[model samples]
Target: MRFYQATRFLFPGSLRLRMLALCSVGTHIPLLALAGWQLATGRADWPSLGLVIGATLVGTLFTLLCIDALLAPVRIATRAVAALEREQTAALTAVRDGDLLAELVVGVNRATEATKVRIATLDDAAHRDPLTGLLNRRGFLTRTEAARDGTVALIDLDRFKAVNDQFGHDAGDAILQDFAAYLARGVRRSDCVARWGGEEFAVFFPETEEGEAAGILHRIVRRMGAGLIDRPDGSPVTCSGGVVALDGETIGQAMTRADAALYAAKRAGRNQLRVSDAHIRLD
Candidate 1:
C-alpha cells in the first residue's frame, strides 16, 4: 500500500506500475550479480548483456498484462463496495467461484449481504414510530407512493388528549400501541398501517374498493367501541376516520379528502367513518 501511494504520483490508480517496478528490480538484481561475476572472470560480453536486458523487459511487460486478468475478483469487490457506499443498490452475490482470489470474492459477497441487511434495518427504523412499532408518516408515504390505485383512510383517536392529560403520556403511549396493534390485526398483509403523528394513524388497502375498505373500517370501529382497549378515563377507546379512494389519484391527493372527511366524522360525533360525497362511497 505504501509503495502504491508513492508510485501513484507517477501513475495514478495503476497498481500494475508498482508491480512492474518490483518485478523489474527483482529480475534485474540477479542479472546485475551475474554480470559483475562474469566481468570479474574476464567473460563479460555486450551482446549477451543486451540480450538479457531485452528478455527481462519483454517478460515484465507480458507479466503485467497477464496479472490484470487475475485481479478480476478485486475489481468486482471494489465496485460492489463503491455502490453500497453510495446507497445505490443491494443484494449482492459472488461474481463467480474457482478464481485464484476466490476467498477474497467470497468474503466480499458475505460482507455485502450483511451490509445490505443492516442498511435495510436502519431504513426501517427511520420510517417507523418506535412507540407503536408501526410505520411513521414518512414510511407510509414512501411505501404507498407507487400504490396509487387503492383505498386509504386517516384515523384519529377521539378525545385522546383527555387521556394524555389525565393519565400521563406513558399510559397514552400504551393506548397508542394497543390501537396500532388492533389496526394491524384488522388489515390484511397486503394492507398498510402507519402512525401519522400524535394520535392519528393512516391505513392503506392496495387495489381495494372504497366499499370493502369501509366495511373493514366499520368492523374495526365497532370492535374498538366494544372496549378492545380502554382509555385511562375507563371509557371505551373510540376513533374517527375518513375513507377515500385512489382510483386515479396519488396518496397525497387523497389525503386532503380523507383528512376533511376525518374531521367531518369528528364533528358529527366520533367512532364513525365518512367518505367524500359524490365520490367513492363506502356507505
Candidate 2:
C-alpha cells in the first residue's frame, strides 16, 4: 500500500487522476509478473496471458472515466470559493441544495455581512462626540477640507461657568446638548457644526463668503438674545461668535483669527458676533 501511494509523486495531475494511476499500476504490475512466472514455468499458455492484459486495459479506462465524473462537482465548488475570496459576489451560484458546500456558502455570506456592519459602527464611534452626539474636533477637521475657500466660525457660550456653578453639572450637560442641537438646526445641509471643546463650538460653511457667514452668525446672536434656549431653571443661554474668511489662509491661521475675534465679541458684549479682518491684504 505504501509503495502504491508513492506512485502518486510520479504523475503530474489532479488527486483523482493520480489515485487512478496508482491503482492501475498496482493491479497490472502484479498480474503481469505472475503471468510471466507462470509462462516461464510452462503453467500458463500465451492465449490466457493475452486475455489478462486486455482485461486490465479495459478496466483501467473505465475506472478513470468514473473518477473524472465524480470529481466534477468538487472542482466547481473550489472555483466558487475562490471567487468569494476575491470579493466578487457572495452567492455560490453553482452550488445546489441539501449539500455541505451550500451550507458553507451561506455561512460565508453571513460572516461578510456581519463584518461590514461592525466596520460601519466603529467608524461612526470614532468620529462622533460621546456626550452631545456632535462631530468632535478631529471629525470636524477631517470633514471641513472642502471649506478651504469659504468661512470658519468659533463660538463660545457666554457665562457658561456660572451655569455649571449655579445649577449642577447635569444641568450644564443638558444645556450643552440642547445648544448643539440648536446650532445643527440653524445651519444648512452643507455646513458642519462641531464641539470644539468645553463651552466652545466650531462651524464651517463651504463655498460661503465671509460677509454671508457673518450674516448667519448675526441671526444666531439675535435668536440667542431672544431667550429661545431653555434651561433647567428657566435661565437664558447666550453665545458669542467670531467669523473669518478662509481666503489664502491655512486652517490654523483661520482658527487663530476666529478665536481672537471671539474674544473681541466677549469684550464688546455677551451676545454678539465679530468679523475678523486678519486675512485682508493692505495691497
Top candidate on lDDT is 1
Candidate 2 stretches greater than 4 Å from native: 1-106, 278-283
Candidate 2, 1-283: lDDT as tens digits: 4653455354433455566767688669967897979978989877877888888888887887787788687667656655545553555554444343334455467557756777888887888888899998888887875456889999999999988898888989988998898888888888888999998999988889888888887787778778878566786798998899887776667888899888888887668888866422111
lDDT of each: 0.80, 0.77
* Candidate 2 residue pairs that clash: none
Clashes of 2: 0
| Best candidate (score: TM-score) | 1
lDDT, residue 269, candidate 2? 65
* lDDT score for residue 32 of model 2: 82
lDDT of 1: 0.80
Q: Tens-digit lDDT track for model 1 on 230-255?
A: 97667899988999888688898898
Q: What is the lDDT of residue 219 in candidate 1?
A: 86
